[model samples]
Target chain A: MTAAVETAQTTTIHGDRVSLLRVLGPAHVWALGVGIVLVGEFTGWNFAADKGGALAALIVCWIVGLLYTSVAMIDSEVTSTVAAAGGQYAQAKHIVGPLMAFNVALFLVFAYTMLEVSDAILLGDTIVAKAGVEGLTHNSFIAATIVVLAWLNYRGVLMTLNVNFVITAIAYVSIVVLFFSVSPWTQGAVLKLNELVTPGNALPYGWIGVIAAFQFGIWYYLGIEGTTQAAEEVRSPARSLPYGTMAGMITLLIAAAMTWYVCASLMPWEYLGITYYPLWDAGKLTGSPLLENLLFIATLLAALASANGCINDAARAWFSLGRDRYLPSWFSAVHPRYRTPYRSILFLLPIALAFAFIADLNQAITFSILSGVLQYTFMSINIMMFRKKWPLGSIRRGYTHPFHPLPAIVLFCLCVVTFFAIFLGFGSQLIAMVAFYFLISLWFHFYRYRFVRRGDQFTMPWPKPQGY
Target chain B: MWMALSYACWGISIVLALWMLYDWFKVDTTYSEDMLTSSREGELEAVSEKHRI
Candidate 1:
């Protein structure tokens, strides 16, 4: 443990007192991950790789799932140690100074916000398309969704969580039905899967799809940690945060891989790129009227379920900012009636409404991915820092992290690689985001040191930076 | 073990979702302050001020 860096005595705002039942068990956390990523079909993830004849990409997806064991196992210990409300922001502030931690939170705010905004756009597009408008030709679809969902969230978290519990349930039901339907038909598919992994069918050796699949897998698994971010609302953070992250990842990895294999093996590779919503297409092909409606309703439910959870999550960054005095104090105030961050929730609606009205879904995904990658990278580093500072004896544990430096180094490198990979994956928007953040951060601290003086007075050995 | 159980639970959840069409027939507007024990401006402000770094 670092001699000087003792853990801070901080009990941050974890909204309202609730029953132990309110805290999601790991299963719900995992379900939340599956809900976010396993949309209708992840045609978006591997269509090109599948067509480039990357049969091996499927196995590579499994390989990446294996790596989640190492990644999530470590997260279990770290989250247990610091199960605070701000997720990575709390962890990062504890490890690095607030300045660097602030950067992480700032980027993370964009990551989750963009993700919610994009999902809202997708929701809008789906509803609008049903009405018979040529999609890309008009700006109507994404716009309508943002307006509706934004209003839904502005109303409250109970509304958000209650609806979330319902929709996420239905969405998951459809996914299971899809796998089972494929199972009845493709009885021998998984056993005879060697043919699918042959050289000709797989992506070329060392193909980028392997990495892209990993990126998608990791990003798709991004929000499990988010379950901890809402730790305050839960009855117990110490128990739920640790178990939720571990359990959730394990569930998502198995569920996603199994569902992917069943669908991918049964459906022709040629059909993937043709449909944005592949499960429904798969259902139509199955000729199961019951199944198709179930899958359609299931996917719609997922998008709906996820929208509420994600929107509630997005407001947290603003709420944290408000709590920390980065924004108005009102932003941090919890609703007296709702016990949720009303100002921050209200803060989120206008921005989401604006993006929903103005931007397309893919653009929102690109921004979401870029910002999210930064938070993930920071989180991996935060674990490493905690290892240096905390006495291992102080943390009560079932699973202990292997000796430091090695795991931390490996995690840090993977995080760095993923960060760069995301930048490349979303090309120019990433560059634009970097520029945008730098400008905003610069402007934020510009007039500082001259008049305003703020920072961690207790921790400083020397005088603090101008205005923190 | 965790993975196997996760799969089983997911399958079970599918059955649960189908019930949504029947169960969620009329929407219920959820209140935001599901956990607010009572209006505690004093406690809320104390908690709020404590948060300022």
Candidate 2:
């Protein structure tokens, strides 16, 4: 993607953080806490619900989550290193040059935006489908949620999280209730170990299906960095971030796994895969419309709450970029009262809204998966570089992945493979990412012509501290 | 009940995080020098020198 390479933009020490109300500490962040990520109930259930792959899938989730933990841990550390307002893009831009950083910033926003759109589209579809309602435009619902999110965020960051809080609470209640209904009754449905471990224990569909099938599970862990993105605004970065992502992941693991198990035990795999509303399907198997609606609401809340992470996190990324003059000054403009970037809001909202009018659930999912891989790769690299350059002192200096280099190496390689997996999974459509990169290039071209050459050199300078 | 309680615990935590930010971190685009310390004018040049943006 193209970034408006700042030639030598004037420097400003006017970095402002959204009030603490916008920052979260470990006190609030939970592991795998997000329900919307588990929304791909169909895909997750596909493996664990049937095909006798429950045990295998569970092991796979543990493995993948474990692998990702290092990256998540490292991210918490490096991101916390500078309490300054600059986020990943800032860190990358400073480490690399402005141009490279700009490209990364563009890529990060593009990926995050696509992910949000995908979640919105799916949740909308899940809701309508579960209702047995026809003519439901899934993408529209997704798009609409983005609009609402944009609207709420524009009012300020607190509004966005407030919305998330309400939405998440409702969704959590519904999910827990669904669990209650499905758990005790559905327990014991997992395949017998002996049935599989012996000779012809249904040789899995080779490693390809196994890896590709595991992609959805990987996504459940992706947004754990939500706290990292919001680090600067946080009061006590050292403690909040290190634990927040860990908490988020832990929350997701148990919640998602249990949800999968509950659904898997209650119904058949094909049933889970076929319905857009996997949770609702679980309820229906129990023959409860009330329960179905309950799940439907949960799905919606999960998706919306997940979007909260996007609205605050993604915009902040762009806001960070704007602050660096990597993109444009417009994005850096914060509302007088709300303290949030009003500029990026204008940009993000319209595109999300347009996407609502077009595109489908699958497209959003594809975009998210592809972009997510890109962000993960860059973030892992950034952490490794930071650790190599700056020796750690206090946890406040930066949060390091427990094992350090090993996890970083593994995550970096895994991401590279995931990138390849995207092309294989999406085929011709994979070109969309390439196209996105080029489009960003074009944007950079225009941005440079108008800004950089016009004496708006945005090259970030050497590190400067406050206390002298 | 444990699951429900856990979910509730998670919910309260998020709300608390939101509260921590006073909802203002939502507006910060990057961790800039201006953010860490309130407006201490002469520090801009020093802060800039100390931290690489």
Indicate the residue-level lDDT of A454 in model 1.
42
Docking class of 2: incorrect
- Candidate with top TM-score is 2
Q: What tens digits encode model 2's per-residue C-alpha lDDT throughout A1-468?
A: 011112111122243332223344454444122423445443333433232344445555666676567656766666555443445565665554465566666666765677677667666666555445444445445545675566677665545655565666666566677777654543344322343333343224445544554455565465665555665555566567667667666666666666665655665444443445666666666677898767766776777777666766678777766654555555666554455565576568668656655877667666766666666787777766666555454123535557778788888877765666565567666686768777876777676635543233223233332222
* C-alpha TM-score for every candidate: 0.74, 0.75
Query: How many residue pairs of model 1 clash at the backbone?
Result: 11
Each prediction's interface RMSD? 16.3, 13.9
Per-residue lDDT tens digits for candidate 1, residues A158-210, read 45555565666677666676777666454463323444445565565355655
Q: iRMS for model 2?
A: 13.9
TM-score of the second chain of model 2 compared to its true counterpart: 0.42
